[model samples]
Target: MRLVRGALRAWRDSFDCGGRSVAMWFPGHMAKGLRQMKGKLQKVDCLVEVHDARIPFSGRNPVFQEALGVRPHLLLLNKMDLADLKEKSRILEQLKQEGLKNVIFTDCEREENIKEVVPLITELVSSNQRYQRAENVEYCIMVIGVPNVGKSSLINALRRLHLKKGKASQVGGEPGITKAVLTKIQVSERPVMYLIDTPGVLSPRIGSVETGLKLALCGTIRDYLVGEDVMADYLLYNLNKHQLFKYVERYGLDAPCDDIESVLKRVALKLGKTRKVKVLTGTGDVNVIAPDYNAAGYEFVRTFRKGELGKVMLD
Candidate 1:
């Protein structure tokens, strides 16, 4: 983690979208999932909105607030292990000002802070008179979030903690792993609680190109949709801005670099990520070996996601 102290070169103040559209990334399935979730609001007792802790401010689908704001809402910022939450109090304060009073940081894979989820939901639901279904003793809460924010992992964690059961929802690293709203899966036996798991959905239009890039970096949006080269460049700019120089040692670089091309070239050569390319010569057509920039970009993004480069707050 060596830091180069000198006159630093200027990085990109803002990213250009290059006339790229985010509409293509918002598929038809996400729209259908939103509709289905809205239709199930009558039976829902609470709304558990999950999101990546690294991106707490950006990439949340505003449609959830507009359509499902009637119920008691709790925001679960998952993947705390990968986020740098030194300013957690400030983040919470900002969220509270935005009308989100309930927020919890959790890591579902390690089951960290898993016990607090049910109790918090119980308190919120009991305090609200709207959910007073006198005839029913069971609690039905709907879990919603954008794609690839560990919504399914949270459900499985609760089930394992309370019921000693296996997974009921499919888990994956990519976005849109769960395609549709699933049936209510019972997670607790004491208060008779059942959770409805919904597929991850994104807004039809993102707030801006920067927000979209943040979403892509956090795996909310697919890498191919945003282009790996562009995402890698943004990631480099962010790491340099935050002074997270761990990538330098991890990739065997002597000092911090401001250029993505040089960084990717070194990464490709070190990892042996190369491909054969056809070349035109005076002698005849020839094939030459060249560094695979795409492969290097993919690896760079992967390392950041896995926390190898160090924890960061991308918001």
Candidate 2:
């Protein structure tokens, strides 16, 4: 799709979160899951943190890092297919400065770079003296990440690639799919490897609204928690900032848009998602067709999640 050539318009430099907080999305299950994960960490060999590649620098649950940082760690930035990774080296350099030397960019949907997982785990485990003393040949690994960042998808992909097995850990689009620490699922047979899939955990105190919005945009948090309208607005801001205008073609807009309500209204009408609402007038209340902004917002968000709107890096 060709983006229309139009005069550059001034877009909002930043998004106003309207005094919102990320405290709303921290459910009881998340805290329970974190405690449960620590209990089983005694038997774990490697801790793999699967996070969204789009926001490599944001929304990672610091609690996980603090509690489970003792083990040999691997940072697997999943969902690379949906991210615009124009400068991966820069991202790597930043992570390296932050003392993260083991990081892999992956697309669990297509199982890209999945084969590297088991080997890397093997190397990390072998190098670490703590886990290397194990008597059994079978290696038990643990998977951790914030919600909806493809933890289950990565496990399923590894199983598919290594063991030719199906998804033992259930997968879902919404957050908190795996509410508790799951039993070990086998993904390899040669060296006898197993993976313990844990619930995706978010930072108890989300740093700021911008960080929350980025996580919400990546579907790490629920839409209603962040107000779909504003989430869509922030998304629009990000799309324009990144110069990713695929939404223009997707929504049949004549040009790029800054107003999220207009874009969502267009999406609602285009998708035939209008609803009839009663309006009070001088005469009486009359039914009028109105665009379903919630539905449109959902569709717009889902479209971006599916990578139809374009590759975006929301960090």
Candidate 3:
């Protein structure tokens, strides 16, 4: 990576949001999900909030805390395999300061730390007051988070780990996979534990544009809403800032670059992700090959999302 650093242009000190507002995509389904979740909160014993480990600090819906804060809460930062956690201690400290004392970093794919979830939830619920359901032995836990942060995967993982069962919930790369609060699925036979899955909700009012971009980059939000090209550019800016030049080697670039176009051009050419366009020649219109910037941007963003570039800490 250092081989490309000497010739690399000065990295961006700060990202410019370019007067873009935080993507406020609280669609009807999200609003409906929130209402349904609140309506069912009375029966829920605990709230297990899942989120992308890459952006642990950003994009958490404040509405969850305000409306459903009465229940025992456990924050699960899912997809830990894709995050840079050199400062995990600091992340936990900050979360503790913010009143999220019960936090767990999890990766559903490898089932990393999956076994600890039940014990931790049991402890948290046992220590806290269970409101009106004190006599109930079966624990009902609700999983909530922004879209595409592995809410369904966590439920499926728990079911697979504890019950030795197949998928209990649907998993997808896009947001809004679960449109409503799903029927509670039994994950454990011993404790009689059940989990409720809900559609990922976004806060109507985000903290900042940078926070929104981070969420978008993490696939918590739709790519089209943020514009693929712009998302790719912002991603490039971030990769350069962190000195993560895996793109240089992956895309066969000579060195790390600050310009998004140059890097994407190489990506498009190498991947053969080009399109045909008609050029207005003097004699007549002729077809020509043009690098598909939008497709290249989409691929770039998706590659990062898959953690192929490198583990990144966007928060």
Separately for all candidates shown, the number of backbone clashes (residues 3 or more apart, or on different chains) is 0, 0, 0
* Best of the two (1, 3) by lDDT: 1
Q: Model 1 residue 221 lDDT?
A: 93
Arranged by TM-score with the best first, the candidates are 3, 2, 1
Model 1: colliding residue pairs: none
Which tens-of-lDDT digit does each residue in 148-251 have in candidate 2? 99999988998999888887889998888999898999999877899998888888788898898899999999877777878888889998888788888878
Which wins on TM-score, candidate 1 or candidate 3? 3
lDDT of each: 0.90, 0.89, 0.90
Please give, for residues 1-315, the per-residue lDDT of candidate 3 as tens digits.
Answer: 356444547888898888987556889999999999999988888999999999889989999999888988999999999999999999999999999999999999999999999999888888885454455489999999889999999999999999899998999989889998899999987788999999999998778878878888998888766778789999999898888989999999988888999999999998999999999989999999999998899899999999999899987
Model 1 C-alpha lDDT per residue in residues 43-109, reported as the tens digit of each score: 9999999999999999898899899989999999999999999999999999999999999999999
Measured against the true structure, the TM-scores of the candidates, in listed sequence, are 0.93, 0.94, 0.94
Which candidate number would show the highest TM-score if scored against the true structure?
A: 3
Indicate the worst ten consecutive residues by lDDT in candidate 3: 1-10
Error of 3 at 286 (Å): 4.6
